[model samples]
Each structure stands twice: as structure tokens, then as C-alpha cells.
Target: MLRTTIMGLCLAAALASPAAAHFQELLPSADVLPEGGTVDLDLVFTHPMDRGPHMQMEKPLRFGMLREGQTTDLLPKLVETVNGGKTAWRTSIDLKEPGTAIFFVEPKPYWEPAEGKYIIHYTKVVVDSFSTGEGWDEMVGLPVEIRPLTRPSGLWTGNLFTGVVTKGGQPVPYAEVEIEFVNDGSVTAPNDAFITQVLKADANGTFSYAMPRAGWWGFAALTEAETTMKSPEGKDVPVEAGALIWVKATDMGKAP
Candidate 1:
């Protein structure tokens, strides 16, 4: 009886915390569009490292881009598509000029029974067009956001990427950040801990992480929402607000 009880408790603990990391994928075909080309973008909610079991995403509350201090609405252009065998969004945009375009998305509140709270990730990705590489540090003014201290594009493997976590335009010291890579089924984690690397900001709300491999890495700064929202059960519950950013790192080797 004691052995059975112990096994039951272990299962409960595992169920409470999942090994898969949830990331709002705001992936672009290329982070830097040389010569002002078109960019294919995919927006989805999933465990990027695992690349499976994607969660269904509703129409986003807001999806747009900021260019030269102006906001362009992109929500009307989103088309329904299947990503990782789940419903997701896909869109494309052409860069006509040389400048920086910061694309952002505010996903609808996602209800998770395991965490017993709604999650809303304000996700952004920077794309530099025509070698201009301008304004990569522009803030999207999200409720919770990671303002990139390092340039978000054109990073090589082993380069250290840094950002500042902010809430309501104020620094959030010691904010918890989660990191994950977009796995294409080529990598495997030795354990659950390796799946999602966790870090915290410093006293000044700055945090950095060095990438060991080349691919897309996502940084998510998590915080509890200021207000509660109604759950599916008609009860008010806390919300988890995440400030997410995606950066691509490249390998330094020449192609054979």
C-alpha cells in the first residue's frame, strides 16, 4: 500500500508540471531579408522544442507591425493554416524599402487546465530588410515586454543575447525568463530540465543567455497579470502574462 501511494504522489507531481515548454511561435522565413524580399511568417502556440502537440489558437486579439514609429494592422491579412497538425496562422509581407520591421502578436487568452490560469504571450520578432539593420531595439509597448539589449537579428552561435524585462514601462527586477529552441526533431533533451532553460533578470531587469547551437531561440519573461480573468468554470483565476521574443542564431562554418 505504501509503494502504491508513493507512485500515485509521483504521478501527481509530474502531471502538475509538464516537461514540454509552451512557446508562442512567431517564426519568420528569414530574420534578415536581403535586398528587400518577401518574408513568410508563421504564428502558432506550441512546444517548439518538441515540435508536436500544438495547442489550438484562436484569432489573435491583435497582430501588427511597427515600422518607423508607425503601426500597421496585419490581423486582417492572417489566414488559417495547420501547423504541427494544429490550427495556426500564416501570413506574408514584402519589404519595399530599407528599414527595420518589428512584427508583434497579442494572442487571445489561452486557458490551461493544468496551470488553472489563462496565458497571454505578447510575442515579437525583428526582421531587418535590405541590410539596413535599423531600429532593432524599438519597443512595441506591450504590457510585459523584453526590450532587446542585443540586436535581435544576425547573431551567430555562441553569441550572448541580452534583454531587459519590463512591465508597464518599468523594469521588472529578478523577473523569471524561460528559454527554448525550435527543435526540428534533430535534438533531444537528456531530461526534462534540459528542455526549458530558466533564467532570471538582474537587479536592473537585464538578463543574458549564450546560445550553444545555431537555430531559433525564444526568450519568455513570465509574470502574473495585474487582474484576474474568468476561467471556463465561471470562476475568476489569475493570468500568466509572458513577454516573448524570438532570435535566430547561425553557424559559422562554410558550406561544403
Candidate 2:
């Protein structure tokens, strides 16, 4: 019983907190078009502020992108209300002209976390930008083959999910693989209702799963060392199953 309780706490701790910023910055979808010029937006983060003898950290303020997503960090724009008074911090951009406009915005710290080194809620945006990712195949120095495998027979909830985890052109053995849902943070601890499934790589950096559920999914993972760094501290750390690689499984014949 003691062991089970400890394990349960560990699992809860891991999922209880979020690690680093989801994506370093508000990544832009693609290279800025010639027509795209310097863009500017707002930045805001929420926190538990005490107003009366009784305090509540419930409401969330609408936010806008304040800077571009880049390796460099920038100043943040924080709007605060104290004693029924409102205060704000705003910043601007000068993509100046078009042509080769590489807009890089730094993420500013809006608010400090009440307990941890970071704000309980870490949020940011890029004015009019969106971003996605494509990893490098370092092994042989090429892009790897990342194909969704054919569905396994006699299964409905999940299909055969096979993908290559390569680096510098070769398979990354022992690399962890995972699938998770894209969280639309409407409320805190939103995924608490759903059970997330996980998988690991083999000596060949291959992974398989019986599918955590019959629904949309995203795939993500990192090298063992990298994964360790991202794991949160205090209580049991939560495992980070990366972005879901959306998949659909129409049936589950009889998951054996």
C-alpha cells in the first residue's frame, strides 16, 4: 500500500506541472513572404494575485503575440490589476519593410511563478505568426523516413504505429517515443479526464503501441538525456509525451 501510494504521487506530480515553454516562441508557419513585414502583438501571462482578504486566481485575460519566436529572448508585456487599478506593459516591432523579413521575437517574462522558478502559467504569442517543426536526420545527413505503418490486424482501438527515430543519419536506439493530445488550455489540468498512452524505442529506435485510445494522436520523444532534463522536479515528475501525430483508428476488432 505504501509503495502504491508513493508511485501514485509520483505519477500525479509528473502530470501536475508543466515543464519548459511548449514551443520556445510563437513560431511562424513558414518563411515570411515578401509581403509580410514587421509584425507586432501583445503578450500576457496569468497569475494568482491577491485582491481582498480572500483571493482567487480564476479569470484568464485574452492575450496577443508580443514578439516573434526566435532563439533570442525579448521583453514581455504584462497587464496587471491591483486594488481595482489596471497597469500594462507593451512593446512594438519594426519588420520595417518586406523582401527577406526574418522576424525574430524574444519571449519576455510576464509574471513570476508563485512557488516555482517560473510562472504557473507560461503563455506567449507571435502577433500574426504560427509555427511547426521538422526534425533533422543527422546520421546519414538526410531526412529520415517517418511513415505511419499499416494498421495491425484484429485491432480497432489502435493500429500498428511504427516510426523511425533517427539522428545524424542513423537510428537512435533507446530513444523514447510517445503520443499525446494537443491541449487547448481552456482550463487547468485539462487532460486529467483522458488517459495518455506511451511507448519506448527498441535497440533499433523503433516503437510500437496498442494505442492508448481510438482517437486523434500526436507523436513526440527525445533522447534519453534530453528527456531527463525536461522532466519536472518535486513530487513525481510528469512524463512529457510530445505533440500528437494525429491518427484515426476506425475499429478495434479485439485488442489482444
Candidate 3:
């Protein structure tokens, strides 16, 4: 009887604790940059839907934009910023061309004690300048990446977003993807499960999810890294390599 009661209590305690989903956010001031204008970006490692317990981020290993089959280094523009007492990064870039610019960041491996592993989310976001909208489908060739089957820009609510998960330029069969919205603090989840929706890729490594409402939705595909890293406690731990992409959806119309 005592053992049964103890087990029940433990289960209840675990359920009572909120599960925070980690997301690497690369948010631009606007998804479509106007000609002769600058687009600002905020790079943070946090639980977007939960509004944080923002994690401290070290300097990114790589930060740049890929356009027209060329990559431009943007690391020189990053400036350290603080939010909720945690370190983050901010940068602004001038958009002069009429083509699509895909900005990406390879952050330093973050040690997550709660998960017992290090996490490195290779995050990317697309910005269309001057309405050219070209080159949105090009892959930046990260270790793990999501190649969007959809255009990834100017999406409407209820539109199905599809993408293929890839590692080392090869498709990953039945890859697991986690989807979450950048909650504006107005949206609340009824339970923890609703915070992050899970989906699996098809045999071709393609997964699809429709944005239920208009907002920024993030899709993260996690895979085991080929290498391990030393933890803060001097122990070697497995690495969680994540390929993350973000897109914005707009409402079709208002109610009558």
C-alpha cells in the first residue's frame, strides 16, 4: 500500500510540472524587407510558446545569409543583448536587392541539464526583399536542415506547410518534427501536450502541418549528432542536433 501511494504521488508531481519546449528563434522585424530598408533580427534560444526562462547563448559558430548561390557572413554584425537576465543576439542587415535572403545561424552547443544532453539547433528564416521572392527553396547545406517544399513565405492560415528533413544532404526517413507557435503571451495551452505538436515525416522525409491560426510557427526536426561533447560536469554526453525553420502565416479574412 505504501509503495503504491508513493508511486501515485510521484506520477502526480511529474504531471504537475510544466514541460518547456526548447526552440531557437530567428525573428526578423518583418518577413518581407522593403527596398532600401534595413531588417532587424533577434536571435534567442528559449521556449517561445512559454515566453521563456530564456537560455543563455554564447557567440554563434556561424551567422550569415544565403542568396543567389552565395553565402555572406553576418557574424560581424551580431551584438550581444540581454533578455530576462539571459544572453541573446541582435543584428540588422540592409536589404538592397530584390531576391530572397535566407538567414541562418549555427549556435554553440547548449548544455541542457534537464534533458541530460547538449542541444544545437541550426535555425533559419526567410526574408523576401522587394517582392522578388526568388531562391526561397535553396538549401544552405547544414548538418541537419529542413528544405521547404512550400515557398515558406506569404502563407495564409490553414495553408499546409510541407518540408523535407535532411541530414548531410540526405533525406531522413520518418523523421520526427516538433511544431510550436511563438505565443504572444495571449495564447495559453490547455495542457503541456498542446504546447508543442509532434509530426512524423513520410518515407520521403517530408512532413506537413497546417497553421491553425495566423502567427509565426516553428518546425524543429531533431536527430542524434554524430559526435559527443563534454558537459560542464566533465562527462561526455550525446548531442541533440536540431534543424529548425520558421514561417509566418496570415489570416485569410475576418468574421462577418
Candidate 4:
């Protein structure tokens, strides 16, 4: 008899427990990816402070935007963190043009001269919101993503290497993999064009980087390369290509 009562109480307690909740995160979007490669995006979302995600909490979250690359060397150029959700931490960018995007989309418009991806890292929360039993749902969100559909900068039949150095077929662990935009037929090579930071490979032997502009660029296992240089005595001397290597650039594009 005691066991039966105890079991009934346990069942009631289990039924009384609050259900697990889920919060829908909001993403900002770009209105346009300028043809000349300059565009501004709007960060808009409805945030109900007294709800599931915000939780009446003032603890700041981080928000920032980096870059994403497309297929073509010069594919059309286009446009991170958790909370403060603050402005001093954010800024805009100017891409050269021919950016591409590869967000999750149909036919996977990959390498097709056009593609799609959502603009990331903009920090703007809409003021008004309507509530429900669980929490308030956002009505409007900045929805933007694009695609240039260009070939991946670094293509391989298998995986690529990154971070450390390898020679004579030595398996260099921790080598970094990276891509650099170069003057191909895509863009005229803007004066502002510079090398992005080195991207390291993961344990899966994968290294990837995002591009912010559209143009012909190259991908290479970053390493010290020997180049022929003219010596002061007019003799050939070996020079290093720094910590860079490259692949061919292709036509890239970003969606509006």
C-alpha cells in the first residue's frame, strides 16, 4: 500500500515538472550588396527582455561580423559572437565586387556564378514584441544571404593541409590552410586588398576562411616558399614568399 501511494506521488510530481523551453535566435540582414562592393545591412529583431532568451537578464552577449567567401576568384563580394549586443564592437565593410555565398539552399547553387547565405553579425533589436504562453516571438528579422557560386578557393579530391610545414610528402600536423584574393580577371585589385589572417585546420583535416570581396584569388598551404630574386651582383638569389601559397581565383558573386 505504501509503495502504491509513493508511486502515485512520483507520477504526479513528474507531471507537475515544467517543460523544457526553446528560444528562437534572431539574425540581422543586409539590404543590398553594392555592385561597387560597398553595402550596409540592417540589424533588426524583436527582443522581449522578460522572455525565454533574454530572461530578464542584463548579462551582455557578443555580436560581430567577419567575412565569408564565394566560388569565383572574383565572384561578387558580399557580406559572430554571442551578446552586449553593443555597437562600439561592430563596423561596416567595403568589398571589391564579385562576391558569392553558400548558405544552405536548393540545388546548392554552389560554384554556379551565384549563391546564397545570410548576412551575419549585425546588432539591432526591434523594440516591439507580442507575447505568448512560452515567450514573445519576433515578427520581423533582417533576412539576407547570397551566393556567387564560384569554385571553392582551395579544391581537393581529398582534404587539404594547414598550419605547420610539410616537404617531401611529410605529414605536417597542425599546418594552417588559407586563401588569398589575388588579381585575376575578377576585380582590378583594390588598393585595400590585403591578406586575411591565417586559418588553421581542424582535427578533421579541414581549414576554411571567409571572403569579403569578389575577385580572383588563390588558396595555398601557408608556408615558406623560395623565390628567385636578383642579387646585388646580378646573380639569382632565393627569396621567401612569406607564409603564403595560393590557388587560382574564379568569378564570385553574392546575393542581394
Q: What TM-score number comes out for model 2?
A: 0.33
lDDT of 3 by residue, 56-153 (tens): 99999999999999999999999999976899999999888789999999999999887789999999999998867789999999999999999888
Global lDDT scores for all candidate models: 0.92, 0.35, 0.91, 0.28
**Which digits, one per residue and each the tens of the lDDT, describe model 4 over residues 1-256?**
9999999999898767532111112221332233434333222211211122222111123232222322222111122222334221122345453333211101100111111111112122111111111111111111211111223332232223222233322433455543444322344323322322345544533454544444322333433323444444565544322122222222233332
For candidate 1, write residues 198-254 as lDDT tens digits. 999999999999999888999999999999999989999999999999999989882
Which is the winner by TM-score between candidate 1 and candidate 3?
1
TM-score of each: 0.94, 0.33, 0.92, 0.23
lDDT, residue 235, candidate 3: 94
Question: Looking at candidate 1, what is the lDDT of residue 43?
Answer: 95
| lDDT computed for candidate 4 | 0.28
- What's the candidate order when arranged by decreasing lDDT? 1, 3, 2, 4
* lDDT: the better of candidates 1 and 3: 1
Please list the residue runs of candidate 3 whose C-alpha ends up more than 4 Å from where it truly belongs after superposition: 1-18, 34-36, 253-256
* Clash totals for all candidate models: 0, 27, 0, 65
Best by lDDT: 1
